[model samples]
Target: MSGLLALLDDVAAIAKVAAASVDDVAGMAAKAGTKAAGVVIDDAAVTPKYVHGFEGKRELPIIWKITKGSLFNKLVVLLPAAMLMNAFAPWLITPLLMLGGAYLSFEGAEKIFHRLFPHADHEVEEDMDVGDPVHLEEARVRGAIKTDFILSAEIMTITLAAIPEGAFWMEAVTLALVAVAITAAVYGSVALIVKMDDIGLFMAATARTGFGRSLGTGLVKGMPKLMVFLSTVGTAAMLWVGGSIIIHGLDVLGWPVLYDTIHRWAEAVAHGVSEGLAGLAAWATSALSYGIFGLAFGMILIPLVTRVIGPVWSVLTGGSKPAAH
Candidate 1:
């Protein structure tokens, strides 16, 4: 009886520890996930376009394919690379983060240019025409996977940077959780966004009542506007986040003046508002500044990327490349 009681005590204690660890992981993952929300928003906003021309039936499948690729990017490729970086050259994280920030800026700026010019994507439209559905699907999947790798690198690095140092397995578990959680969040949103039109169409045509049909018609009509809103928000977020990262990176690298100046300006402007509103004002002010900086950087990069980097890449690849569709 005594031996059994002692064993029970040990088992209970083990269970308690296991439960605690699980709780800790959930807490950490949530916090880290919140930190990465800016990128997450942009990722969701941008991904649906890859399947833009596909048939209705193919949209979800493409998203699924991309989601799988995104998982592979995070779990198989980036997760291991991040762990190795943490183990070995942890110092490289900040620099790599800066590079990612630069990329975000470039993408954001490119989008802005596309909007301003209104024909910037003409080359892409011209290139993307496909005859074979299978081949087109494969190409889209490959393209999305490649894009996801870059975004996953950014997401993982952001998550890794958010985490405090802990046991190796703890870090791994937190990251894996983040990976799966983010993938579900992003692609799940994509699936809904893509299928919404269909749902709306179905309701418009088949709803039993007028109100239902009107609601469905409204949804069908509103989807385009919603996508526009999402894309706009996404671009702004990318620039803001990228700019913020660069500023923070600068602060980390012994140049705090720019960040401090921006903060002070934000606070000063925010002072005119109510206390709660003031904080929001300050944040928005700072975000705007960072976004402007990102926009400038992106503008500079556009020409360089198109004229210099593209040519160089083309040469290196011996002219073999994605159709840019």
Candidate 2:
């Protein structure tokens, strides 16, 4: 009887440890996910555009296909790469993260530049000219997946950086959990945003109540504006997160000028404000400083990318040159 009781106690202890591990994984995943929020928002914002011009029936399937591709990118490709980096080349993480930050800065700046000085989008024109719907869909899907791979790399790297140093299994499990959760959140949001107008139309046409019909009508009208708002927010986030990453990275690498300057400015602003709002003031000041620097840095990169890198890449890949922005 005592032997059986001892075994039972051992089993309960094991179960308790397992439960604790699960909680740890969940907690780490949530924290890591928040760290990658800027990329996540941009992913959700960018995806719906890929489904444009497709039939409503096709939109969900396209999103599903992209979602599956995104999962594969994170799990099969990026997660392994991230693990390898952690194991063998841990020092590369910060530099790679800074590279991703630069990309985000360039992207956000390009969007703003295009908005300020409009240019014809040759890529969209090419898509419009494609005769075969099936081919166009395939091309768009491939393009989106390619784009997702880069963003997924960024997300995975950010998550990996956010994870506290721990056991190999714990880190692996945390990354996998973060991968699944982020993919679901991003693509699920994309699916809903893409289909919202259809839902609105259905409700408008079929709802029995007057309020329902009005709400449906409002949704239909509001979706475009909502998309624009999301895009603007995503761009701002990209710049903010990217700039912050670069500044912090510079500090880590022994170039603390930008980082220290930003902090000093934030501190000054914080002290100038009431105690209740000081923290908010500091954060706002820091963010604005980072964003302004990011915008300036990105602007410098624009001509170099378009004029030099774009042409070289096109030549090397045997692809058409990118259109000037």
Candidate 3:
């Protein structure tokens, strides 16, 4: 009887520890996901554009394919690579993060640069004239997946950096959860965004009530504006997030001047507000500074990337570079 009781108690203790570990994984995953929000938003915002010219029926299938590709990128490729980094060269994380941040800044700045000096994309014109829908779809999917791999690398790294030190298995589980959760959130939102017009058209044509038809019309009209809003927001977010990541990485690497300056400024702004709003004030101030820094850094990168890096990349790949994201 005593031996049985002891065995049961040991099993119960093990169960309790397992439950606590699960809770920890969930909490860490949520925090890590929050840190990667900018990338997540950009991913969702960018994906809809890939599906733009495809027929309505094919939209979901393409999204599904991309979603699968995204998951593969995150789980099979990025996850293991991140784990290896964590295991062997943990110090590399900060530099890698800064590199990713710089990429984001460059991307955001390039968008602004293009807006200022818009160039005709002959390649885009040629792409549209592809005779077979299937071939076009394949090319778009491959392009989007390649883009997703870059973004996913950033997201996974951000998540890995955000997670507190824990057992290897714990880190692995947390990262895996982050991967699955983020992939679902991004692609699911893309799916909805792309299909919304079709849904609106259906309702506009066949809704049983006048109000329903009006609602559908409004949705159809509103979607274009929504896409514009999403794009603008996504750009701003990328700049802010990228800039902040670089700033944070610098701080980690012992260059505290920029980080401290931003912190002091944020605090000074926060001090004027009520206690409850102070955090919000501080955050906004920091975000604003980061965004400005991102914009400046990105602008500097634009000419170099287009003039130098693009040619080098084209040479290395033996193909012309795709348009900048």
Candidate 4:
């Protein structure tokens, strides 16, 4: 009887430890996911476009394919890479993160530039002109997966950076949980957004009540505006997060001038505000300052990227030249 009681007590203790570990994983994953919010928003916003113009029946299937590709990108490719980096080359994390941040900044700024300049998208036109639906779908899926790879790398890196150092297994589990949870959240939201029009149309046509019909009609009409809103918000988030990351990276790497200046400016603004709103004012000021810096940095990168890097990449990859921006 004593032996049995001891065994039971040992098992109970193990169970308690396991439960605590699970909670820790959940908490860490949530925080890491929050840190990667800009990339997550952009991923969700960008994915629906790959399904655009597809037959409604095919839309879900296409999204499923892309979602699978995204999972593979994050879980199979990025997760292992991140783990290896953490294990061996931990010092490289900040530099790599800054590179990713610069990429995000460039992407956001390029979007704004395109919007302002209103240039034609030759690549999009080429895709639209493709003869076979099957081939076009394949090409679009490949492009989207390629894009997702870059974004997923950013997400995983940001998540890894956010995780507090602990046991190796704890870090591994936290990263894995973050990868799965973030991929599911992004793709799940994409699925819903892509299908929303159909859902709204079905409701509008089939709903029994007048209010239901009106609501459905509203959804159908509102989706386009919603997409535009999401795009704008995603761009802003990218600039804010990217600039902040760069500044933070610089601070980590022993150059605190920019970071200190931004902090001082934010503090000055915060002190000028009423006590009740001081924190909000400071945060807003910091975010805006970061975003402005990101936009300028990104604009500088655009000419170099489009004029120099794009051509070099094309030559090396043996691909056609990128469209002129």
Cα error of candidate 1 at position 130, Å? 3.0
Q: Which residue ranges in model 2 land beyond 4 Å of their true spot?
A: 128-130, 320-325
Candidate 1 local distance difference test against the native: 0.86
Could you report the Cα RMSD, in angstroms, for every candidate shown?
Answer: 2.0, 1.8, 1.3, 1.7
Model 3 TM-score relative to the real fold: 0.97
> Residue by residue across 88-115, what tens digits does model 3's lDDT show?
9999999999998988899888777778
> How do these models rank on TM-score, best leading?
3, 4, 2, 1
Residue-level lDDT for 113 in candidate 3: 77
Cα lDDT tens digits for candidate 2, 147-252: 8998999999999999999999999999999999999999999999998999999999999999999999999999999999999988888888889889999999
Candidate 1 structure quality by residue, lDDT tens digits, 180-260: 999999999999999999999999999999999999999999999999998889889889888888888888889999899
Candidate 2 residue 200 Cα shift, in angstroms, is 0.8
Pairs that collide in candidate 1 are none
Q: Relative to the true structure, how large is the alpha-carbon lDDT of every model?
A: 0.86, 0.89, 0.92, 0.89
Candidate 2, residue 135: the lDDT equals: 92
Candidate 2 residue 258 C-alpha distance from true site, Å = 0.9
**CA displacement after TM-score superposition, residue 166 of candidate 3 (Å):** 0.6
